[model samples]
Structure formats: C-alpha cells, structure tokens
Target chain A: MRTSKKYIVTGLFLILLIILLSCELMLGSVYIPAQNVFSVLTNNEHQNEVWNTIILQSRLPRALGAIIAGASLSVSGLLMQVLFRNPLASPYILGISSGAGLGVALITLGSVGIGFTFVPNGLSLVASAMLGALLVFSIVFFISLKVKDVMTLLIAGVLIGSIANAVVNIIQLHASALAVKTFVLWTLASLDQLEMTDIKLLYIICPLTLIGSFLLSKQLNALLMGEKYARSVGVNILLSRILIILFSGILAASITAFCGPIGFIGIMVPHIVRIIFRTNHHKLLILFSVLIGSCTLLAADLMAHYFITSVSLPINAITALIGIPVILWLLLGKKDISKTI
Target chain B: MHTILEIKNIDVSYKQQKVLENGSLTLKESTLTALLGRNGSGKSTLLNTISGFLKPTKGEILVSGVNIYKSNPATRARLISYLESTPLSPQNISVKELVAFGRYPYLDLFTSLSESDLTIIHSALFQCGLSQFSDRFFNELSDGEKQKVFIARAIAQNTPLIILDEPTSHLDFIARREIINLLKTLCLKENKTIFFSSHEPELCVELADRFVVTANHTFSEVNKTEVLKTLINS
Candidate 1:
C-alpha cells in the first residue's frame, strides 16, 4: 500500500518516456507524419523506401540509443555515488568512461597508416571499449580488495583515468590528423552512430545489468549506510564492493563502447530521482532511476537535435551543461546531501 | 547464569600497537553490561573484536559457545547485533525502513517482508517508543531519538546479544539518562543481553547491572562504587 505512490510515479515516468520517444521519431531533420511513424514502427511496409530507411534504420536506432545510453549512464552513476559515498561521483568524471575511451583510442589510433582497412563499425568500437573498460575495472577491482576504502578507489580510479588520458594524448600526438580528429569526435559523444544491431546488443546487456543491480539492491542499501554498518548487519563488504565495481564498470563500458563517453547522466539522474522519490529503497530507486534516466537522455537527444538543425551538437556537452547546474542546485537547495548517502 | 558472550584472551592490536592483551571475560545472559576504561583503553577495539569486525592477533570469541569468526556473516548477524559509536545516519531513509534492515539476516535478497517480519519491525519500533516517529526521516530525528532508532534496528535483528561501542557518546545529559534507562528496559523487558562501552563510568555505575573495567591491558570486574572511584583516580 505504501509502495503505491512509487508505482504511480514510475508509471508517469514511463508515460513521459513513451511520449518523448514519439517526439524523437517525429522531430528529426526530416519530419514524418505521426501516423507514418506509427505504421513504420509497427513493421508495416510504407510506400516510400527512403522515408522507411530514415525511420526504421536511422531515427529508431538513434532514439533507442538515447534511451539505453541514458539508462546505463544513470544507473552506473547511482552505483559510483553509493560506492564512493560522495554525491559528486560519476562514470565520466571518475575516469571509468575514459578507460573505455582509451580502449577505443588504442584501436582507432594504433591502426592508422598500417594499411589495415578494417571497418570501424559500432560492434568493433563497442568491443574495443569494453576491453579497455574491463582492463581499468580489473585494476580498481583488485585494489578495492586491498584498500577497502571507497575514497581510495575513487582516487585510484581518477589517477588511473588520468594516466589513461595522458597515454591517449601521447597516442594522439603521434597519430595522423585524421586519426586524431576521429578520436576527438568520439569523445564529443553522439547517438547518431548507433544502429539497430547495436541497440539489440544493448537491449541484452543493459537490461541484464539493470536486473543485476536490482538483485543487489539490498547490498547497495547496506553500503549507503557505511562499510562497518553494512558488515555488522551481515553484508559481505568485500564481495559487495567488487560486485559494485564490476557492475558499474560493465554498464559504463557498454555505453562508452556504443556512444562514446556521454557525460553526467550517471551523477545527474540519480540525484534527480533522489530529490523526486525521496525514498531510500534501492530497488525502488533503481526503477525510478532507469525511467528518469531514459526520459533525460531523450530530452537531451531532442535538445541536441534541435539546438541547430544545420548540425547536431554532442549529447555529452548537453548533459554536462544540464548536469552541473542540477548539482549546484542540489548542493545549494538545502537537499541535506551531506548525510552519509 | 548462562554465559552469553565469552571474550577469550584476545590480543587486539592496531598497526602493531597492541591496545588489549590477554583479555578474557564472560558475560551472562539478561544483564546490562558497561565496559569502562579511560581514553585509549581499547574499549572500542574490544567491542569491535567481539562484534567480529576485527580478528584478534591470537584468540577466538565465542557467542553462545559457537566460534563467531568461523561462522558466516549472516549467521553471526543472527547471533549478535553491533552498533558503532557515532553511527552515520544515512539520509532519505525512514526510521521504519532503517529498522527493517535489522531483519536482513533472516531474509534473502529477493525475499520481501513476511507477516512476522513486519510484526517484528513494528515491535522493535514500539519497544523504543518510536511508533509515532517511524515514518520520519532518520536524519531528521533528534539526537536521542536517533540513538533509539539505532537500538531499535539492533532489536529488530532479534539477536541474542547486542553490543554498542558508545550509544550515548553524543547525547546531552537528559538524553544520556533516557538512553541508559532504555537500555535497562531492553535488558529487563526484552531479556536481551546489552553490552555497551562508555567513558561515562559515573553514570554507567548507577545504571548497569554489571561493570567490566579495562585498564593497564587487562579486564576485571568491579562494583558500581569501585568503578566510579577507579575511573576518578585513574
């Protein structure tokens, strides 16, 4: 009975997400009728092949891309914040995303001028990105075992991230202008590159990871209290720590592989959910987070789409632009974020 | 009286600096215990060791004759509930939900509250006189009320033994008295073994049924008046 309100709130968020999805389909560079968008989505054959390709191949995947990317970034942000016990922690800022970016960089830059003409498709980049993220994740994961301090891991992640960034910069310096330009564009972060195949892959990884987070909801709740408090209550602190790092790493790495390092969704979305839901149940919070995160990136995608019809802006820049202010307001708005979680 | 807790010759050290050595003590069931010592007397360390957070350099702790360190966290949690001094009050959690975390040991990750689990949570809240405050945010409660919430969480754990490093360290005089009386009530009414560490030996001597003093690397029993005199002179 008490949970009825969360159901209503989540239901509303889902509705908002659907409405935004419809808007995304209708409001791209070439506007199609709301009716045609529906017919195409329902898998009905339309008369015009070009309009069908634009709808089925381009707009649909891009919109799904925004939804999955938003959800993944926000959920991982929630993980990082709880893991570090700091409200400011995010996958992008923590260098988790940069670790993925490094993976992309090694592949994107290293093969330059070698006459290796491999198609740099979404699947390949995603694989490279996942590899890079897992590499840094393992380092942080093992260190978490010895350190047992989230603050230390936070510092280590940032340091490892910086080292990775420095290395990427060196690679860029030696790389050809074309290679460097492509790497820079990837860092800008966009949803345009995602295809239906990439979206299908994410449909598996993202949902599974979200479910994994839901299963560990109790441990995350324990963690929000503090390590000693959690352990005293029978939570396996070390196991929980390792699992959290891996889960967040996988979530971040998957998104970075697909869409580059989309900034601030993780930090910004969880805070918004906290402010709205105002409850501490991670299961419920995770649900609210995924919904709100889905809506957020859709809105961000729309904003990027409409910012200038001539050329779209990077989704990463838009999220940071929106995210920084929300953080500022949360800190200044008497939100009581200074409490342990 | 049955021995509910046995701390056997524990040698606890922090970074090679031994704080307690060769300390052996047994506490009986249904008694209020106060661990008294001067500053840096290893009272917290001993409590943490007993709670299974710290492994002693050489000794084992037994809860109801079972070696706690050899047991799993969930099993140990069912046997003993522990509270740290100055516990962090996580924001955005209601007092009721916070107390429900106590039932964690009995339930799995996917299990929702059964009828009896809800009953126990309500009882823990009722025992602490927090029925009206159950829905309030834990961080918004007053200092004394917050401390009672912590105790209520431990109570809801339904463990035989509850250990606290310092429950009243941050309370005012009236709050301190209220907490002491509450602990006394828990021992009497609920028949729970409540062992707590405190620097306030004078207040503790008046309240506790048993006094265990730690000084000069040893633990020895003392009477109420003797505890007061020893703490004052030392």
Candidate 2:
C-alpha cells in the first residue's frame, strides 16, 4: 500500500522485493519475458516447458534462497551488534561465517580421501560448520569471561577469524581441483542453484530462529544498558550471552551451510535499519532488519545475475559494492554522532 | 542491621600490577557510602569485586554474610547491583524496557513479563522521572535522561545495595545536581544503601552521609565533620 514514510519505506522495500522476485524468475541462462514469467508464476501451464522448468526448478528456489540467506544473515548481524554492543559488529567482521566455512572445509575438503572414516558426511558437514561456529563462539565467549572487556572480545574475534582463514587457506592448498573448485564456487557465492528442498529447509528453520531472536528482545534491551545493569535486573549475564551467541551461531551456520558465506548483508543491513528507524528497540529493529536484509539481498542477487553475461558475478561482490558506501556513510556520520568510547 | 556486603583484606591486581593491596571495605544495611579517590585508585576494582565481576587476589567479599565469590553470579546479582564507569551503549531500548530488565532475577528464562514485573517497572520509571520517556529510544534521550533510565533500572532491580562507578561524569552542572539529589532521595526514601565512587570531593562532602576517602592505595572513613575538614584541608 502507498503510505507514509514508514509504510513508504516498507512499500519501497516491497516494490524492490517484487522487482527482485520478477528478476529472479525472468533472468538466468535463459531470458523469459516478464509476461511469460507471470504466466508460469500463475497457473498457466502452457508456457515453454524448458523455461517453465528453469523457473520452477531453478528461479523460484533461488529467490527463496536469497530471502532466507538474507533474513538469517541479517538476524545474526543484529545479534552481533547487540552482543558486542558495537554498531560495527557483524557476522562477517566477527568471522562467524568464515568459521562456518572452515567447518565446511574440514568436514568436506579437509576430510576428503583421508583415512578417518568417522569424519562424517553431508550431515556432518553441517554439524562441523555448526561446531566450528560454536568453537569460535565459545572462545570469544570464554575470553569475554576472562577479559571483561568488549573491545578485547572484538579484537579476539578478529584474531580467531584470521586463524580460521589461515587454516582454510592451508586446506585449500591440499584440496583436489574438483574439491577446490567446489569450495571456490561456493565461496564466490550465488543463490542460483538452490533446490526446493533447501528453500523448505530455510523456510522452516529461519522463522523459528528469528522468533527465538525476537523472544530475547528484553534481554537484548537490557544489554544495551550494559552488562552490569542486565545483571542487576536479574538477567544471568552468562546465560543470556550464551543464548544470544548460540542463536547467532545457529543462524549464521545455517545460512553459511546453504548460501556459502554471503557477505555484507550480515554486516551492513542492521545499521541501515537502525539509522532509518533511529531506534534501538529490539522488537522493531529485529523485524525491520529482517525485511531490509531480505530486500537488500534479493536486490543484490538480481544484480549479480543480470549485470554480466555467461559468468554470474558473485553475490558477495555485489553486496560489497553496495555495503562499502554505507560503511563510508556511517564513518562520515560518526563525526556528528559523538560516539564516546 | 546485617552487613549486606563485606570486603575483607582484598588484594586485586591487573597481572603484575597491584591495583588494590589488602584493600577492604564493609557495606552495612541502609548506609550510603561515597568512595572518593583519584583517577588511578582502585575504587572501581573494589566495587567490581564486591559485585562478583572480579576476583580478589587474596581476600573475600561476603554479601549478606555469605562469601559472594563462593556464590554463583546469578544469586550474587540478586543481592547486589553494580553500575559501571559508563552506562552501556544504548541499543534501541526504551525506558520501560530498560527498567523491566531489573525484573530479570525474578522472571524465569524466556518467561513472559509478569504483572508484578510490570508494577516494579512502572514504579521504577515513575520514581526516576522516566515515565514520559518510557517508550522513547535510549539513544534519543540526553545524557541526563539516560542516567536516570539507569537509576530507574537499578530501582526496579529492588536490591538492598546498589554500587555505581562514577554516575555523574558526563552530566552538566544542573544535571549533576539533580542526579545527586535523586540518589540521596533514593537512600532516604527507599532505605537502599548506595555506594558510588566519585572524584568530586566537594559534592561528596556536601551530599553523602558517610564518605570513604580512597587515596594512595588506602581508605579511611570521613564522618560529617571530618568530611568538611578533609574538604577544606585538601
């Protein structure tokens, strides 16, 4: 509905959303016109069978993929922001996604052809990613316990990320061309190949995870006042933090498992939500972030596909292109905001 | 009245650097004590140790006659509250939401906010002049308003003792006076023992019931007469 600024923002977001869905349905290796796209989307079964197959088997799932990855990554981003209490904190900066990647490498690339039969399979790869994310989460968490400092935890997360990157690089060195190619392709990142099964998986998981995130609204609200205040209020600081981190890790790992470490959406969208709404109320911020994140990723996905021919530009590349400007805008804006500390 | 917090022979250090050596302080029920010190003094450390955020090298902190360090953090939090040097960064939180955090100890994990919790939150907001700002985002509030929001949170916490680390550093002249007045009123009206560290000796000498002068790694009590003498002599 056309409406006021808030609804307008929502409408613009939805408009962008409709365009993105259409782009996803219409553009690919084969270009289906807008009409044909709509026809197939509706119940007109007489559309070109091949184009219809591509639309049903490929485009719809891929569009749904973008939506899920976007929502999941953004929620994790919001969690990182609250957890660290730093506006700049995000899933990518904290290296949570990279941790997931390392898990994938270890389980898939790292364990390939090795003698340890217990390294597990596809399920284990997901488990490994979750485990990897949990490992970093725990390390950061434990260090937080010892350090009692937010900045130290941020620095430690960076170090953890760098270490994970180094390990990933080492594994990449020994990987087979096929395995390495798979990893690289996944790393280049795209939502193009998402199957209906993956979409269903995300649809089921993301809503539950997001609800859990929203349920922590009061806890997160308390955290913004500082940890001590939260403790004073009877929030078991460790338990609340652990819950937030675990929730963040699950969302990050789940998205990374399917989307191959999509970037910048997790890093930038939350801030945009905060800036636009100018509120730290977690209930509003959480929902706004989810919508903006989904829209932003879908828009980015559409651009990644249509902007070039033959080879799709990585979705990460598209996000960085958009995300960096926002970062610079925030940096410029910081001078005016007076961020003491 | 039973002692709500006991600091006995505390020796806290940052690695090799000793911050507090054999430092000790006792907080009794229904007492407001000012922790006065220079910048590098260990006032913050002492407060943190009492609140179970840090460990003393060779001492014990007893809350309600129980060693606070021996108790788990959650139980200890319910007994004593510590505010840090600066208020935590504001996420998009409202005054009402911030105050509700004080009810956390009473509420189960993931439990819905209860009627009693709402009563506490409302009273806290009303007590701190934050009722009008209940739905306003924390960041949108001025520094003075934010400080009040935190005080409201502590009030809602309903703890017997509240420890604050420099609650008025960023406020202007009028705001500082208002906050100090508010805190003193809380002590008298609620019988909540307030312990806070401040560099402002004149403010302490004027406002506090009893002031603890922490300097040169030692502490001493300054009674009302001694407080004036200390203020003039220093």
Candidate 3:
C-alpha cells in the first residue's frame, strides 16, 4: 500500500512539474500565447520576433536555471540533514554559501578599494565563488577528522560562517557605491540572469552529483539508526561520511557559484517531501525531492516575475515567504518536528 | 559441545585509562550466558571489545577458530550481531523495515532483498512476538516492545553469536522477565550463542544457562547461587 502511494505521489509531482514549467515559459512579463511558446520551443521560430526572443533567450534559460538550482539545493539539504542527524541542517548550514558570498563580495566589493573599476565577468565570478566554497569546506573536512563528533563540526561550521560574513561586511563598508550595489543585488539572488552557458555547466554538475547521492540511499538509511548500528551492519562509516560531504559540497558550491546563494528552498523542500511521503527512506526521498523541488522553484519564479504588473521581486524574498510558513506549521502541528530527523 | 567464542587475555581502556586488564572467557554453542556486574564495573567495555567496537591493547578474540579482528567488517557482521544499550530511535521507520536492516551484510550494492531474506525477517518478527506490530513506527512502541524489535533485528541478521549490552534495562518487572524469557527461547530454538549484560540478576537467574561476573577488572564464571551473592555483595 505504501509503495503504491509512493508511485501515485511521484506521478502527481511529475505532472505538476510539467504544468509549472509550461506556465513559467508562457506566462511571463510579455505574456506569450501557449501555441507561440510551443512553436518557439519546438521549431526555434515564431512569427513574432520579440516573442521568439523572449521565449528562447530570457524565459528558457531562467526556467532551466530554476529547475537545476531547486533540485540541487533540495538534495543537498537532504544529505546534510541525514549526515548531521539534525533537522535544521541545510545546504548552507556548513557556511559554503557564506564562503561563496564572501568570494563574490571580495571580487565585486573589494576590487573597488584596489582601484579596479571593470565589471567582473561571469567566468571569474564562478571561479572565485567556487574557490571560496572549497576553501571553507576543506577546513570543515579537516576538522571533522579530529573532532569525532558531528555536533562539534556543526558548531565549527557556524563559527566559520560568522567569520566569513564579518569579513564580507568589512569589505562592503569600504566599497564604492557601484560595487556595493552589485554585491547587495547578488546577495538578493536572481534566477533570471543565468546565461545558457551557466545553465549548461549546472546541468553537467548537479545531475551527476544527484545520481551519486541516490546510489548512497542504502547507506543513508542505515545511518539513520546511528553510526554504530550502521557500522555493525557492514557499512564503512568513514567512507560513507566522506562521500556524502563531497557530494553535498559540490552540489551547493556549483549552484551558489552561479545563482548567488538562493535560500530557503534548500532547507524547506526536504521537510515538505518527508511530510507528504511519510518515510525517511532516501531512495524515495531523493527522487521526489528532485521533482517537487523543481516544481516549487518554478512556481516561485513564476510568481516573482508575474506577481506584480511590471516589477520582478527578488527570488530569495519569494522563497522565504513560502518557506517560513510551512516550517512554522510543521513546528506548531501535532507531530514533533525533531522526531522527523 | 563446540566452542563458539574465545576471548584471550585482552586489555581494554577508555581514554588511555585501563578499564579491563587481562580478561578472558569462552562460550559454547547454543548456550545463553548472562554478564553480571555493578555500575562502572567495565561490563560495557568488555562487551564492546568482544563485539569488535573496541580494539584490545593486547589480546586476540576468536569466533569459531577465526580471529575476529583480522576479518573485514562484513565478515565480522556475519559472525556476530551486537545491540547497544540505547540504540537510536529513528522516526518514520516501520518495525519490519528496521528488522530488514539485518540482511545488509549479505547484500551487494545493486541487489534488493531476496525471498529468503524476506522469510528470515518474517520469522524473526514472529519469534519476537512482533508480527502484529510490524507496521507500527519504532518510536510509537513502548520500551519493552522496542527492545523486542531490536532483538528481532539482531536475530534476522542470522549470525551464530549475538551480543547485547544491558538488554533489559529500564523495563518493568514483567517486561524484564519477558525479555529474558525471549532470549532463552532464541537460544534453545535457534541454537544461537547469546551473551548479554544486565543489571537485574534476579530476573535472569531462572532462565540463564551460564553466568559470567565482571568484578575487579576481570571476568570469572560463577555458579547460579554464587553469581547472585557476588552481584549483591558488590
């Protein structure tokens, strides 16, 4: 009976994702017709050049970016929650997003003080963000070797994140008006600015890492019982821990490098999936998180773009608006939220 | 009777402080051995060392003539199943699903649970009197029922020797008796060599076939009457 329920929910999410993706493509600022959107997507041609460009250039890449970012962040959150055995653990809990932000801040905000006035290109921005994320993650990994307690590692990550944010704020204080504006806008996070090349890079990284996480479902399930029980059942705890960290780190770093730290979705989507599916089994959780995560961000992005007449809200604002209430409801409900972890 | 377990003169330590020094014991096949010790008497340390969770500073442990420390984790898992005093209470896992974790050592990465595995899981649940509660969530069960579910998981592992640390702690008098009785039945019916540590010697006195007492950092086998006296006097 549970297996059939899983199938039905999975099928429903797939259809929901398709509908959301279509709405994202069709109901944008200019409001292209459904048939015109379909023709533009299929034949790469439309009678109206403006609508064609809107569909192919702006809407298409943004839609794909939302899907990849949503799926990557949600899966990363799920891995962190299981790895740390804490429900509040999200992809950004380890400070990788803060590291990425620090990197972007240094390039965009710090460069002003050093008399470099040029706008940083996309490639350089990605490289610096990735470098910062890896640097922080490597430090956490090193500390994990000596600590032997996951709670300590979690505290260390929080402290490291605070230190990185402090440095970013100091740089922001001295930056020029233009540079500070650029840094602030990046922190707000927008899915609409990703180029096709950026989307392609995300396609390569996120799917491979997500597949790797899926293959580790059995180990994750065993670990839910605790490390000792997992080891007794023949799981190599060290190897599994390293692999989980590496996979979640890469996913978070790649998305943050491109999308400027899209928040709330990473922490919120897994809880929603767990509540709906009513199982902690990662095999089912990972698959459904990917689908539902995609649908959620697509819907959020559609609202961010079309909610007002002509003004697009920041993606982060919309996600937090959606995320906070669900989390509040889960906490206030009859079921204890801590038990879910 | 064939000897199923052998512990040579092993020394165990916690944080560089020796807890047990030069300890040795042996167990026969299809027998239930109760470990009786006072608080902080190194009973848990000894059990952990035997279950391969801790490395002895100087000694060797053999299960059925093979050195356990020399084998891989999967091989050790096939040799023995261990239950800690307080296993984690994970949410949203059913009783049957938790028991199926026993087959993990036998499975490769790509293979799902086979028919034989399912049969073993069902039999384990039935033996533990948890068949009707198989669909219940782990946290929803009472302490006694949860202990049985954990034992059912250990039984489903299908190992020759099983080790448990304080299996009957924090239970009512009736639940304690029931757990001991269940352990005794598993030994007689399944022919498993069972070694468990417990604080309640009175509950185990009627059912335990053998008793080993941990006192003064060493292990000694004592008779039924002497074991109770030793525990009370300690």
Give the best candidate by TM-score: 3
Question: How many steric clashes does model 2 contain?
Answer: 4
RMSD of each: 2.0, 5.2, 1.6
Q: Which candidate, 1 or 3, has the higher DockQ?
A: 3
TM-score of chain A of 1: 0.92
Tell me the TM-score of each prediction against the true structure.
0.95, 0.78, 0.97
Candidate 1, which segments miss by more than 4 Å at Cα?
A1-5, A112-121
Q: How accurate is candidate 3 locally (lDDT)?
A: 0.88
lDDT of candidates 1 onward, in order: 0.85, 0.76, 0.88
Query: Where's the lowest-lDDT run of ten residues in candidate 1 chain A?
Result: A112-121
Residues A137-202 of candidate 1 have per-residue lDDT tens digits of: 778777888885678878888998999888888777767777777788889889988888889999
Best by DockQ: 3
User: Candidate 2: which stretches are off by over 4 Å?
Assistant: A1-23, A26-52, A94-153, A163-184, A204-206, A306-311, A322-341, B1-30, B37-41, B56-67, B88-97, B112-119, B130-145, B170-174, B215-222, B228-234
Candidate 3: true interface contacts recovered: 0.63
Q: Chain A TM-score for each candidate, in the given order? A: 0.92, 0.84, 0.96
Second chain alone, TM-score for each candidate? 0.96, 0.92, 0.97
What would the per-residue lDDT of candidate 3 be over residues B34-53, giving only the tens digit for each residue? 99999899899988888888
Candidate 3 docking class? medium
Residue B33 displacement in candidate 3 (angstroms): 0.7
Better of 1 and 2 by DockQ: 1
Candidate number that wins on TM-score, 1 or 2: 1
Candidate 3 lDDT over A157-221, as tens digits, reads 89998899999999989988988888888888888778888888899989999999998988999
